[model samples]
Target: MYKARAWLSRSFTALSSNPLRVCVVGSGPAGFYTAEKTLKAHQEAQVDIIDRLPTPFGLVRSGVAPDHPETKIVINQFSRVVQHERCSFFGNVTLGSSVSLSELRQLYHVVVLAYGAESDRALGIPGEDLIGVHSAREFVWWYNGHPDGKNLSPDLKSTDTAVILGQGNVALDVARILLRPTEELATTDIASYAWTALEGSSIRKVYLVGRRGPVQAACTAKELREILGIKNLYVHIREDDLIKSPTDEEEMKNSRIQRRVYELLSKAAASASSQPMLGQRELHFVFFRKPDSFLESNERSGHVSGVHFEKTALKGGGPGKQYAVGTGEFEDLDCGMVLKSIGYKSVPVNGLPFDNHKGIVPNIRGRVLKNISGDSSQVENGLYVCGWLKRGPTGIIATNLYCAEETVASISEDLEQGVLASSSGLPKPGREGLLQLLDNRNVRPVPFSAWEKIDSEEKRLGSLRNKPKEKLTTYEDLLKVAT
Candidate 1:
């Protein structure tokens, strides 16, 4: 009894003397929420957030639509978190390239992988490789000035029509950007090059296609209303498509949002039938269309001309569980460009166990599991996951708050249980050691203050153009400004 008490006292003393060190990969909403909660939970815990880009605020800066700057107010909150003395931000430091997973494990007591979905799910249909076919992610990145997509230079002047194969918020975002006047977009923080391309675009009509009915739409009512509210834009919808099935009626009975969305679509369809097609631009909400393949343009050899779709209908399951099945009816719609916005997917990091089928790191309550079964006893010590990587790519920005709380709670529990204690009773190297290793590798990490320099430069450029800010679209420009 005396020996056991002595050991417990020693462990307590060691934990009190050695403050916990945490490393968070990615700087998006999930990463920031995790850091915020971690700092609040453990007063002595220090967090270091690293991102691949020189700029912070992952998807908030690059994935969100520019016209909705209100959604980006969270950046201010994240900025305050990084400004805390115990927390730090390091940008332009990639996980796989600049440093490895093993190196991060050696430096911190806990590692939280919050890097968001970096790629989009492919349609896997033929002709997807055509020049004019692009993922909604690529288009979003291009307009937002992400380095990987700034140089896309999609041919917007060749065609008068665009078809986006999804009925999600992102598809609506793409449709709005293509249909909305460039003069209005100029007031936001859209890339200057994208604005220039849009100013000369010949596109006047956009189609938002969905395989399922209106009740099964992946978009929220708010997004649907916003698109329907655009002035001088005609809406086209088949009134029959708005007719809900018995299962769909049950879904609407349970979901107020779905009922609201159905009403908005019905109202638009009614209005569209009464009004003449006299608007400068048009928006079409197409349902029950499943993409079959992309057709090659007759005029432009390697570019897409249109898409062929198989008509689909709801089958099996009830309310919120129905699936789309083909009905053997196929239709073709001619369009200049096609943007596939099915969903975003996360790639695996080295030394991490990934579930390819689900496109997420297998975990239970944010603790990464060694196998696919997600058994609680098989959790990898000191390793955790949060955000879209922990769960699949779903949820709004605020959803990450609860997701992060669960992760931080697990971390707190482990700390209390001494599951995270080092056998040597010594502290990990943390940030100071990370700096030395980075210096040795000749990789320069962009500090938060350096990012402020880039921010100032972007704002200065924006002032010249009388807008919010003109983002630097290339790594060369971003790094040059940061330095």
Candidate 2:
């Protein structure tokens, strides 16, 4: 035990003498988890997490539904990480605009791109650019008070029926938010602007359209059940859509979650009454409907009035592998609002090799590769990726924890092998140098302390309204609060 303690003491001394400087782009779960793991493993490692927003906790603050405050509890854990002695946070610093990848590479010994997928996948059909057609990403952000999403004035006032394309958890979230009582959301951290707008919403029915069958839905059973539990919200499912294929029995035998989801869906459909409750809302699950194009409104030339869908049939495949084949038959459903919740895709950052098709940085495990071929021999030394930027957008928040561990392990291995030894002589300026560069550019970064002030102010304001917290939606307001 004495010898072991002595070795640890020696290790600490060595680490103190030569610390590893890491700059993680994107102050999200992946970035914080990576920093936490890296700092714990390397005693003398210093980390700076950067984000484009004035506030931290990227998706946790903006992507998660305000109604689900329990999920945002992860922010408390992230708060602890940013407050670590070896860690710092630099918010309101745009990656490509304020500081380029080349600049970050020159400033830190190791640069990890944990920036999440910010762009949503397009439906690539006609009339997608019409008014009243929104992406689930921007809609969620707008409701959650993301700076970029503040201007997204979705026309909820013009529509009594809304249609959301895609059957993922995000679609379910949109459905729930539309159908949930405005009074219930009053105590949550939902953006005041969104709350005010939603309070005046005329929406009464929401259609969740999926190209595939019920067994092949991307949403988890928990989210589906939550949508089903909303008071005065009646769920509708076509009986024919629930009919199983020949392979469904075999597939259901292999996965318990799938079985449970099927069971819940079936039970909900069986219990649904033909007539909705008085002043109640309706949620319709329309399966095997592939969106072909959006229909234009007669009253408003540029606004969407309905969606044209091509009927689809299930083809032979395994449980999760089922494919949708389009039939010639077409159907139209009238609605003023259409939100596409297909999925999210990462955008290409300057100086980073992005796989255009895959919508992710080209990398082998965590090491950023120079080409799309993924040849490890052609790796860009000292550059790495994690989270949705490394892998395509998928998985839950906990998924990033393991993803960060793997990336940090790779970084540690490279450091031990002296792959980054050449960085010792480089003009790696660390935080001071980076801050100086930002100063020169007149970029005011919101430090962790300032963010704490904003957080406190938000909570204080929320208390006045009996809500969890009120977010500052505008950039100017956030900066004002932080300053």
Candidate 3:
């Protein structure tokens, strides 16, 4: 049996008298930042940040490109935040799956749904369901040792020509990973098993596909620059995609990264016409075509062979206004592997108001809106959101510092107005939910103690490998050694 009464202490005063108990659901930048800011703002406040994975730092651990170790330095700062005495880090506790949202509300004065987007947005093409097709989210996780990543061997062996469906920084990362040398990958936190498989990959070409023209590409200038700088990867671009002339003064203010990317891309386009790709592995950046279907190798094989596309033209205004004008020309890009990096996907937490379309808890200025009253300006208190789950998937690691600040400020305001403390914490569901999960024989979640064993073991394995660490990829392997 589980004890809620003993855990729930009425010793803590309401916001009107003192601090509030804040529970943030997710340990990503947004969640950690929120926790850090709240603790800094209030002396008596206690914070708990929960994560589904035994380890914390959601995207920092699983989403960031492993080769970019500098970017991952963020984990150190987040680790400091979690070590605060007022802060409690709960690992291996999954919301929605392991614990109901109602129980969480009863345990904390305010609950923030910061469990960032978990699913990948689709390209809606025919070959999506094929064997070689995968989402960038899954692929990145595999290389980064995310607990739920699929085995890397299957995807690595099946493709020579890979097509990625997006122009964001994530797409560039996949392209670089596909072509980067084995020596380059050894220095990062990429899983050893995944790197070993990638070292032997047959993939010779990676195409970063975008549905709009080069000027409209969502990829940041810095990502495009680093990608082109890869020594082993041959960066290719078509002349048609090269932006010809600057339109306005604002357009002329391109960042240094953008200016450098232009110089490199111009050279690539010029060479694309004269040379037959220099090396076997070519990273071609393509734009202005929308996916039509995923070409599968007969119904029996269930393997993705290629992708069909409908060439698109710009319409109306810039960026957001630029829609797929007229769909006339059609083209097919041959690809053995397909990665839909179109975007990110998230779902509403149980017992919270969710906008089905946006896949986020509905909030106004970080304040979770319970109901739209007769007067629309006012919002009910006691709930909030932070991170990707709050503001969709975008922004660099540092940007979350500001995002979390805003939510924490709103929470402070709510506390000053005596909104959250009135509700107190969520109820005690006891072991009923966990018992059901155990009955189903879902992989036994690693307890905090078990995670410590895994952590120590991983470090021990890393010492032998001459690298940071190696992770156990399988649930069976993890349980066998961890237990």
Candidate 4:
């Protein structure tokens, strides 16, 4: 008991004498939230956030729909978090290239991997690699001016009809962008190149295809409502498809949000025939259809002309618990473009234990586990994860707050337990060591102050154009602005 007490005293003394050094390997919502929680709980801890891009706010800046500018208000909060005295931002510094995970483990006492999903799930179907097929992830990033997406020029000129395979908010977002008037998006921070391409878009019809029924839709009620409210866009729905089964009815009764969504969908379907307008684009909800393959166009070789689908039906479970089973029946929809919006997936970082099935780093609570089962005894000390990388790619932006808090709590508990004690005789050098290494590598990291300059420049350009901030889509331009 005396030795135990003495060890505890020494641990606290060590932590108190020198502040804990924490390195967060992402500048997204999860990273910022973790930093905020860590800074608030451990006043002596210094946190450093690093990102692959010069600008921060991962998805908020690159993944969100351009027209939904209000959703990005969280950036203001993230900015303040980065500006904290105990926190530092290091942008344009990639984890694998600029420094290895092993190097980070050596430099900081604790390393938090908050880097969100970097890849999209693929639709394992024939002709998916065709010219006209694109992942909704790439499309969203292209419109939002992500440096990696700047070169992706989707062929909007060839298609009057587009089929998006998924019913999530992301699918709705893609549909809304395709159907929304260009004038509405002009005022937003959409990439100028995207705006130019969209102005010439021939798309007039969009089919939001999903494998599951309406009750199992992944989109939120707010997004559904917004999609329904778009002017000059006629929402087409099959009345039979909206009819709920006895099981679905019971599920809807239990969920207020589901009940409301059903009611709204019913109302829209009922009014579809009565309210008719000319020269209007059509948004069709095609449910219970699983993409079987993409059909090639005879006129344009290697380009997708349409999609083949196997009809699906709900089995056993109810509402969100339901799963889609393919029926013998088959159907085809002729469309020039296909955007697969199934979901996002996290890519495996070098030297990390990633579960390919779950698309996440194998972890118990917040501590990264050694294997896929996440055995408690195999916990990787001083290593943690939060957000989509910890959990799968699920939930909204606000969801990261709770997830990050939980991770921070786990980290705090570990600290108190002395699980983060240095194994080597030498103490970790933390940010100072990292900066010196970065300097040695000739890697010019964009600091928060430099980012502020870029922000100011964007706003200045926006003011001149009478629109939201104009983004630097290319790395060269962004680097120049930052400098």
Question: Each model's TM-score, in the order given?
Answer: 0.96, 0.96, 0.86, 0.95
Clashes of each: 0, 0, 9, 0
Q: What are the runs in model 3 whose C-alpha is more than 4 Å off?
A: 1-19, 243-263, 271-273, 276-279, 298-300, 318-320, 371-380, 422-453, 475-483
> For candidate 1, what's the RMSD?
4.5
Residue 218 lDDT in candidate 3: 68
Query: Where does model 2 exceed 4 Å of error?
Result: 1-15, 422-427
lDDT of 1: 0.89
lDDT of 2 by residue, 1-483 (tens): 343223223322124545678899998899988888777767777889999999999889999999999999999999999999989999999999999999989888889999899998988899999999999999999999898999999988888999999998999998899889999999999999999999999999999999988777878999999999998887899988899887876778888877888888899999999878888899999999999999999999999999999999978656667788999999999999999999999989877888988998988768999989978799898899999999899988998987887787777767766777432434356898889999999999999999999999999999999998988888899999999
lDDT of 4 by residue, 1-483 (tens): 343223223323234557888999999999999998888777678899999999999999998888888999999999999999989999999999999999999999899999999898887789999998999999999999999998889999988999999988999999998888999989989988999999999998999998977876778788999999998779888877987888888888788877877777788888886544778889999889999999999999999999999999898755457788999899899999999998899988888999999899998768999888867999989999999999999999999988887788777768777788542323789999999999999999999999999999888898787777999888898899898
68-185 per-residue lDDT for model 1 (tens digits) = 9999999999999999998999999999999999999999989999998999898788999998999999999999999999878899999999999999899989988998878899
Q: Model 4: which residue pairs collide? A: none
Query: How accurate locally is residue 314 in candidate 3, as Cα lDDT from 0 to 100?
Result: 68
lDDT of each: 0.89, 0.88, 0.72, 0.88
Pick by lDDT: 1 or 4, better one: 1
Write the residue-wise lDDT of candidate 3 on 152-204 in tens digits. Answer: 45467666799988988888888788888878888666788888888889888
The local distance difference test score of model 3 is 0.72
In candidate 1, stretches whose alpha carbon ends up further than 4 angstroms from where it belongs are 1-17, 273-276, 422-424
Query: Residue 351 lDDT in model 4?
Result: 87
Which 10 consecutive positions of candidate 3 have the poorest summed lDDT? 1-10
